[model samples]
Target: MKLTQIATATALFFTAQLAFADNPETQTQPAPAVEFLLPSVEVVASPPSTPLFSITDPKAPRQPLPASDGADYLKTVPGFAAIRSGGTNGDPVLRGMSGSRLSLVANGAPIEGACPARMDAPSSYIAPESYDKVVVVKGPETVLYGPGASAGTVLFERNTPRFTEAGVRASGSLVGGQFGRNDQNVDIAAGTPDVYARVTANKAHEGDYRDGNGNTVPSAWNKWNTDVALGVTPDADTKLELTAGTGDGNARYAGRGMDGVRFRRDSVGLHFEKQNIGKVLRDIDARVFYNEADHRMDNYTLRETPPGSMPMAADVRRRTVGGRIAATFDLSERVEWVAGADWQVNWLASRSVMGIQNLSDMPWTPSATLSNYGVFSELTWFASDVQQVIAGLRFDRAAATDDRQSISGMMSSMPNPTFDEQRTRVLPSGFVRYEQNLRALPLTWYAGIGHTERFPDYWELFSPNSGPAGSVNAFAGIQPEKTTQLDIGAHYRGGAVDAWVSAYAGYVNDFILFTYNTSMGKATSQATNVNAEIFGGEFGATWKPDGHWRVGVSSAYAWGRNADSGAPLPQIPPLVTRFTVDYTLGAWSAGALWRVVSSQHRYALNQGNVVGYDFGPSGGFGVVSLHAQYDINKRTQLTVGVDNLLNKAYSEHLNLAGNAGFGFPANTPVMEPGRTAWARLSFRM
Candidate 1:
């Protein structure tokens, strides 16, 4: 169905409902006991809940129109950026770090995408609204989730639900906007004291958008997802749950030679939890999960085939299986400890067909397999009322195997130098921290040091065309990356005012880097190692002068240099700041957000990660947005917003060069969407 038709139908339905809700008879009824509060539209994300740790509700209304994917949503957080690839599935970067440095977990399991070029990053499969909570832990501060989190860790989780009696509850949202943008979501749950079931689903679509110059950009997409969970709560303190989910989508990218014609996901999981087992043993948690991503990209699916080029497509898939077991212990009155073990394995395979050949008929070829096993323990010591200490340690055994029989080059296939070869390494990571609270003021401060040893991932090992100098291949030449860092932060929470600042400095040994080179009209990439130094920080403050007024400001910056070459690191985001002001009166609220980014004069041309490479220096730009919300009742809310209010033409420094096949000039960055407006109606029962 056409997006405009869908938007018009949705508008008529919502209008009728609003009118019915205003009827005198309905107005006299008493509200339900379970009042669903509608939070003001989130512009700039709130300050961290604790030093370097942030928690936010994923379901909350946010500006820049509600995000279509996880990476889009994370842009609201300080120190977070994305390498744009059209309108959706941008690769997320944290503190100037991307790829495997940042760990992403969903329901305690890791899901990896299959695209060698990172067309479908891990965040691409995530539908932010389908989850209940988002937790971001910056820096390598903890060891409970997984290993090699030198950048940070992001967790998307769902809380277990319990009921005292048999009952049913549901929540939903409908949104429509310009450029034929629309979305629909529904979540329903039913439960009794002993058992519960839930179903969540959503669909999103958008047409090609125009830039400030009113030129069309090839950035259209459609996606849908559905997930279900069933739980058995035999007792109040113990529960078991099972979950299954499937989703698929397609996206058009103006920065690539092909469009994503398929993004398919399948997953299943089992979880068990028991709390308050004894005085010393507080809780035990165990979970197992299996996830698979089947992705396909083509030149003729979402757009016209380029002149003189035949239709071509590639299909890739990755299957991952993982499990974890953890237990919490109250060792003493002043000390608490949590310990866990985890194991993960994933395999990648692919097939390609050209010249009107059927891709499905091509036999899939297994390319690589990777695995990791780790044990971890974290201890927190409450020494006194104002002083605390935290420490963690983990050991991981990682291994990768190359299964390819031959390497495909620009002209012809060649024998694989490292075919059927395997590499394994035993690595360790740990952290120690000290935190203190001021006795005379509402302030807390912390300092920590952490170290992590990371193994080479798939992209660094197999995607590159060549390895470092004097090496057989990337799979055999790349060495493990070791990072040691120090972090310090402070936060103040006084009545009407809240503020936070976090900073880090790190040195990396054998940091993996990618270099792009084009020769004879063909592009190639090579993987190499270098010594690097990195530092960054994020700061924010919020002031609530009165019950009806709120003002906030946040800023973030990162700097990195290649210690070996004395050159600036590629793909680093420039300094950015956000300002927001909000006013609330009764059930109505209004807000505006202004975001400014500094010009990035420092860059390493043709060097970056698998997602994108630095094309050249980029200029900075500023944009403004505004939003307003009205509560129709305790259970319903309507939010409207205008994005890019000034209709500015801007492009982020961390962006891909426009593809020639899309009729874009060479070495040009894709522009962001122009001025657009949208509205969303949400209800809970």
Candidate 2:
């Protein structure tokens, strides 16, 4: 495809307004805070505006009912998919990559899930409506966050509130939807310029939803969260803050043998920032945080025990503590530099019971511990008014230790092969990018290349039953993986049109893959390494014909291969596209969303990440939804919408097979919810 022509064709894409944020006129200005109480149609299909980066407000009202977790909200974006696990807490996949490859952070702190089965994915604990902004950095284009971000990085952030006088401000929303669905959220702040306090809270609940066939799927959930922050502004450019939060929830799943009975989280953090220290030294930022996940899974709590398996329950916990310190330097008028160092430690332990046993009688046992210490530096250079360059380098010492003493098999128990073993690696990562502005065409072009060496994560090391052919176990034999990738893209804005496109290709030297085998009536999961190749991209455009009418369309696709097996990668999403149209006049507005998904024929059954495996090929499908918004005065708003408007029955390409206990045939993909309607009301004070 011709780069210039494609850029012009997608001129009206969802992120057109986002690209305007980088226009010469607004290049130096910080992005304005966005509120969800008043939403725009374009946000439903939003794309990244800058090269490899996209930013959007998390509280925005969207179709398919307001998202139950971060992963649910991300599916609306191009080049992203979610592995459905029931009604909520689906795992997110980007560019065909899942698990540790995607780094996730909240308020500058990392929070990891403790479930080996991934019932509580990192996104599960995230309440999008509680955060101010959601930022995504696709691919391994930068190393400022942490290691193992081969796919990308996602950040959920909150802005500090500064009050000029002693006063109070608050914003909140109430929502109700089909299947007994209901939700409530509120954010409030109070204090003076020198001191301030803020509180954010939310609760959501839903009952089982029926599929198009009028069959009820075992999906239901109830969740709640609350967070508090206290800050001392002291001045305009300097501030210190402390924050803490706790939340817990439970969910039922149709595709799993066990259900998540408890999903608990606890977090605390302290951060300090100082700007404009001097001429050479621009600023300093530092922070420390502690987070923990306590998870419990059982079949009896939310469902009856399967015929073959006895009643069982498992409890797991992971505690993580980390800190980061960074400083910015003004090397020259055209050059800026940032350097930082970070350290994190994670401890994991677990306990379990069988056959109606009391939970309190089970003894806790240590399982594993992992840690990482890293240092990084990044530089941004302004070559001229239309050309720029940016580069970064990072190094980390990653280590893991096994604490288990024995492993239990279907018939007996034996000494653990990797007991008391420790493994460590020194990994390095770096990236460089160049950007140029076409002064005459109102367009910008960018290209970047990056390489990263990743340490095997816990799931890769300890969860598998076996290792490569000659190795005794996964923990003792797995090796670090390496990835090298290149990305390129362009953006264009013309009168009534806006567009953007990004493409990437990469080679993985040691990709960690899993293989499942059944022998002697027992199932075993083996972890192995292989060389692989991957490539994909996303493009879109938007057109605004008049002051009251707008139209837009966008699409994304991804492909990957296992170099060693000569087979298609498992669980890769199929080509997908979305079309949108909206009209607005005075205090009333309306919009329609149309989504099209292609059939996925490729399959690598029993080979995938921990969350899911390929069930089989799926047929293509389409769904349409419509929504309307009303401004009930400046401080209040009302919005209503219906998803699956035509009541079309469908399932996502990336899905989990239904469990027999749910009355679903073995190896069959679970179906999505049927037609649903919802309404939301908002208030600001």
Candidate 2 lDDT tens digits, 1-685: 2334323423332133335434667444443354434665443556566756889877666776888898998888788899997799999999989999999989999879998878899999999989998899989988889997999999999986677667777777777778878788889998888999999999998889898788899999999999999999988788899999999999999988889989999999999999999999989999999999999999899999988879989999999999999999999999999999999999999999888888767888999999999999999999999999999999999999999999877677799978999999999999999999998997888999999999999889888888888998989888998999999998888888888899999999889988776344334688899999999999988889998888988889999999988998888999999988989987789999889999998778778877787757889999999999877655566778888889888888788778877777667788998898877776565
TM-score of each: 0.97, 0.93
TM-score of 2: 0.93
Question: What C-alpha lDDT do the candidate models reach, one value each?
Answer: 0.91, 0.86
RMSD of 1: 2.1
Task: Name the regions of candidate 2 deviating beyond 4 angstroms.
Answer: 1-37, 42-45, 518-523
- Residue 648, candidate 1: C-alpha displacement in angstroms: 0.2
Residue 566 error for model 1, in Å? 0.8
lDDT of 1 by residue, 389-456 (tens): 99999999999999889999886889998999999999999999999999999999999999999999
